[model samples]
Target chain A: MNLSPQQQKIIEIVPQGAPSIVEESLFEVRKKIYPRAVTGLFARWRWGMVIFTQLLFYGLCWVPWNDRQAVLFNIVERKFYLFGLVLWPQDVFYLAILLIISAFSLFLFTAVAGRLWCGFACPQTVYTEVFLWIERVFEGDRGARMKLDSGDMSQVKLLRKGGKVLTWALLAAWTGFTFVGYFTPIHELWGEVWNFRLGPWESFWLCFYSAFTYLNAGHMREQVCKYMCPYARFQGVMFDPDTLVITYDTERGDPRGSRKKGIDPRSEGKGDCVDCQICVQVCPTGIDIRDGLQYECIGCAACIDACDQVMEKMNYPKGLIRYSTENALSQHWGWREILRHVVRPRVLIYMGILSIVVSAFLFGLLTKSSLQVNVIRDRGIMGREVEGGLIENVFRLQVMNVSEHYQFYAVKVEGLPGIKLASDHVIELPAESSRVFTFEVRADPESGKPGSNPISFEIESLLGDAEAHEKATFFIPR
Target chain B: MQKWMWILWPSFIIAGVAEGIFFSLVNPQELYFLGDPVHYSAIATYSIGFLAFWMVCACSSFLTWSLQRPAGEVNARG
Candidate 1:
């Protein structure tokens, strides 16, 4: 067939031996994986974790501490109350430190045991597991779900599917509500729900988070871990030969074939593996463990549980698939031997860094001043010469009461001779709140030289012994 | 930084243009922070929004890369 000049040029640009369109397409269509449920030791641990985490997330908002939510991030009030500790927006460095600590913890954990967080504790895994359980309750097991999806639609199918959707929506919406509750008071949020008067921003966040949770957990499932999760992509960089990962013992399980119930695997000239494929069936990511430790494996150890059960039934030794490091497997080292190598230099370094960060974070929190004073010079007017021959400088002082109780603060100025607070120095600040006050500092023109003299504002709490001193630049006429 | 101008320039232009259009369409006075003298709260708000937006953009970029890959091929890590 004759081709256009543009098409001819495209053909010339094509490399030799490159896969044609028929061989490989650009886009990969997703094939749905229906993971078969299997009961095992790790499965029980996962369920336990699900219960533990969900309890803390859904129930923590209701628990009262000092007549307020136990762990509330009151964004509106710009206060973060974590049990006994109250933090202001100025204390965001603490949050950054918290994030750094979490990152280091992940590094340490991933280096020691691969994807332990992903399998058991990560929100994606936990929520997906819960959503799957909900789906199983409405529908049936793996086989039933597969059949229902492929089969014709019916009343039974409609009811079950509809019921599942409704349940998931309600759960996701409640999750969103609880999430919003951490920022807004849960009781007040509940009142708003009753009155249908939730603020637009709050309502938007609630819906947005709910929809995200539902799509991630209910529909996307493993796709979130496989495609979207950056952690999954980058976690391999943290892995080493000593890192414990889910592995299949290819030396024992290879040369595989099926066998009768009572027949010995050696008699049939085959390895211990009967090739039942149960391990693959139970895998969340639908990868064959026998193919080596792939990044796709979350190291949930469900395959270990499945393979062990198969080994037991066949009167064979267990651990055909288990959590073993590359070095351990290569050296044929057992559990005790593996434990010794876990304390190696890389892990020690991570631990040392983590400890330093943790201690520093704790020290910062412990020594945090209850009274915080931030003085900003009024930009509208720099300085003025008053009738009394005093140089007056206006400033906006933001005084934050970081304690749980109300505080009475008295402001005083220092650094220049005869420098004194020219406005009301005493003010009452509410509990865990900040108020911006316009205050004037006056000093005799002869007392200090012109053009930006350093001054300090001392805030002393009358209600408590807490006090803070913040330094600001005082402008003077040149 | 200069070497990657081909990439950085487009990203910078997109961000700057988008920010301008967005601020104009949604009067920043309606926001909790009125611009001019930037407050700590206003800075914090913008910082968080920038972080969240960048993360979402990163995720979408990854997805686009994934779509461009040949079928049946998997990402291999060394």
Candidate 2:
């Protein structure tokens, strides 16, 4: 083997049996993973998740409640309508709480099961699965895909690739459209799209998001999980010995060698693994679980399903590779023991924090006030002497009815000696609407000191007992 | 390629998160520029704001990565 001086030095620096560093670092070329389709319990569950999430995302914006879109964020109108409840810009507290809830939920989920979200629920994983299904539909399974990629350029290959790409693009476009639909009214958006009248920003976002979906799911594949995702990087810290993760039972499946089916492995002094490499072939990340737990493992358990079939065929007990904790695997513990160990201190702490945030979020949502009010001192004019000997302060009141029913609110002012509203005392507001009312509040000339007097407005719904108390300052000229 | 990704990718993600948090708290209609109300639509505000945020974040990342290079590489370049 002829080697340059630089190559010889690199070989000396690297440990024996490691793949040549030169080959790996030169281009950093990515080998596309052609994950073979596997059918089993986990596969079924994955498909179920794909269907459930896709249906919810694609179909949810079309649902109407109370003659309005049920869950429209409505960025243009600056309102968030969720079922019977309406949230204004001032309700950003709920959004913060929702984000906190999601973070804690992720923590708790990760503590209990290693990468369960990555395996079953992450958008990256789910989209990849959907794209793979489309690929299989158009180009056939792993073997066919590999063959086509390596084979000469042919008419059949081009057609197959074209069909797959077209389908993937359509699905991606729909995904992006549905996402934008959540912010805008879906039906109205459909009308605009059909008329070729999409707003510039809307069109830009639609294209940007569609391209993102195509590149990430179709092209990047495991690269997103292995490199791009921040969650994947930090999730290792949350994992413990008791966390359920995809693992290969090395003690039971060792001295791996190919053997005929139905042959008892004990007779030849071999383990269950037949050196089939089926697990590697089915891996989305192209990792061998028999090498033990790796960060690259998303815990999707396709390897487990693949191994179980191999184990069953070889007249061996299943679960050569399966979902088992580190402690369970090493100690040879049963499911009951594994369950007992899962409630450790780390998991309990995560669970406790998650429950607290979730409950706080729910409580805040349920007890949210039905009416909101903001008092703005009219900037144009200040204290004025009215026809009478009283000092009056001009103000604008922004009142919002956050409920689903129309009601008349009795508005009054107080908090200073004889401070009374000079504007109409009663204002009617439609359901889920806000209005700015300009009103004047008068006070006795000698009320407290002459500079500024504190005042409060009492706006109470006449139909319901809901009330909003807003504070404002009234100025009296010296 | 790897160095470019180290700054660009993470900053891109952070910019998206920043946009979400900022927009949720402050409505575009209420925004003002130089004492005059911003006349752009909500989508335009969000898009421009996101891009502005991405630039700021990417600048910070670029500075950090560039400064933290190995002494050998810096000396070699010089």
Candidate 3:
């Protein structure tokens, strides 16, 4: 390898043992962050949410409904059962609507209180909190964990580290099992687990999901929030000046200096902040809140709690760091002023759109037809001349009963004159089941002209007030 | 090279082993040996599916790496 003149000059100027040009390329080495545990109003609220969300997730899969799981998305059967409502493949639009609603809700929330979902309800945040709790239980607090890592490898260290990993693995495995149980019936899946008879896909998903949970929640932690989350990247666009963010009041907190207890900060030309870095220590993403709002902040409000506690101890007013809008902080406005701006144009628009979408979604779901009929013209032979000078069109009808009870449907064909069904007009369908049946439609030979004729199939459920109408092209030979 | 290996090779091996375990357990005979002895077409389909899986894993791994990397930021002193 020959070095260019520029490379030689660069090497000469650069110090020895420092990162070389090639080594100092784009990729940066990762330094592990040990977040200290803090207890405050926001921390308690986060724990409360963690408990509520985890309980709901782990409990939902076990609850039985109509002798089966209450919320099962049986992909193999291509049916999604939600309580009393059974959504067939044809009802996939409802799922799309649900996703749209979620996205809009996120937009509304971000416009109001920035990153509340990331802080409170996101699965990554929730699982990481749970895993951290488990780790704390096994290997003391943040300081202890850091010391254990820095100290030489020892018996006690191994035991504590091993215990943490084992606990994390168990929790991850249970989470994975519950995830798979959604697609497969939990009770049946449990029986399979006991008998060691899980099918290949089931076992694969179980291990894959478990490994992912373990690696992500236990090891990856805030890294999942910082780089992997697209929402974190795009959330800035949704933010406004009036959006409530976890902020440090630089005006009140700057000119910060270390002072003894009972020393008036104002008299000493110092701000309320006592120069304690508790806020940074408690921060999950390892960013200082005093440096202004950064994109890495999940807005968990841990810094608020930590700062408030320090203020209380120092007899200073609270909210040295608190949730305030950028506009409020800049304008020196009180809480009432900030609340007034919360209902600004952007918020109102989002709320209006969200409400309309939600209402329409509800209306669509409530008025969902129980009967689904799809008519497919046989491609191989479009139309044939059967005996008796009649034109016959072979068609396949896919009838799906989206209800929970057996229903008989009567099928009728109408379009051109003398168009009649050649097979059984009335068919029985099992609950939440779909079947494809091939039947022939015959039209009078002299009634229709050559080319494709428009025809319609009317399926009326005999069991309920549910019916469906589907149109298909009926071809006729010249 | 060592640093790159630390990120790439371990992840590659883990993904490969995981895929092997899944395939061996699932035994997707239909995907790889449909109606006949194992043919090149069947192998091609199976390989394509595996390639798709690896691509997804690579994307996720890259995201994780980028997030954890230290950006040479100087810590603020108050």
lDDT of each: 0.82, 0.88, 0.83
> Where does candidate 3 stray beyond 4 Å?
A1-28, A376-396, A413-423, A438-456, A472-478, B1-53, B56-78
DockQ of 2: 0.54
Residues A1-478 of candidate 2: C-alpha lDDT, one tens digit per residue:
9988877855356567966534233225688889999989899888898889988888889999998899999888878888877878888888788788788788888888888889888999999999999999988999998999999989999999999999999999998998899988999899999999999999998888999999989999898898888888899899889999898888888988988777787799988789999999999988898998888899898998888887777778899898889999989999999989888999888788878878888898888889889999988778988877988889899988888889799999988878898889999999888899999888888876888778899999998658998988889888
Off by over 4 Å in 1: A1-27, A375-398, A410-427, A435-458, A470-478, B1-78
What is the full ranking by TM-score, best candidate first? 2, 3, 1
* Most accurate candidate by TM-score: 2
Whose TM-score is higher: candidate 1's or candidate 3's? 3
Clashing pairs in 2: none
Per-prediction DockQ: 0.06, 0.54, 0.08
Per-residue CA lDDT of candidate 3, range B1-78, in tens? 434443554455556656544543443444434557554432343455566666666666677766765555223321
Which candidate do you rate higher for TM-score, 1 or 2? 2
Candidate 3 global lDDT: 0.83
Better of 2 and 3 by TM-score: 2
Q: Model 2 off-target regions past 4 Å?
A: A1-27, A375-396, A404-406, A413-423, A430-432, A438-456, A471-478, B30-37, B71-78
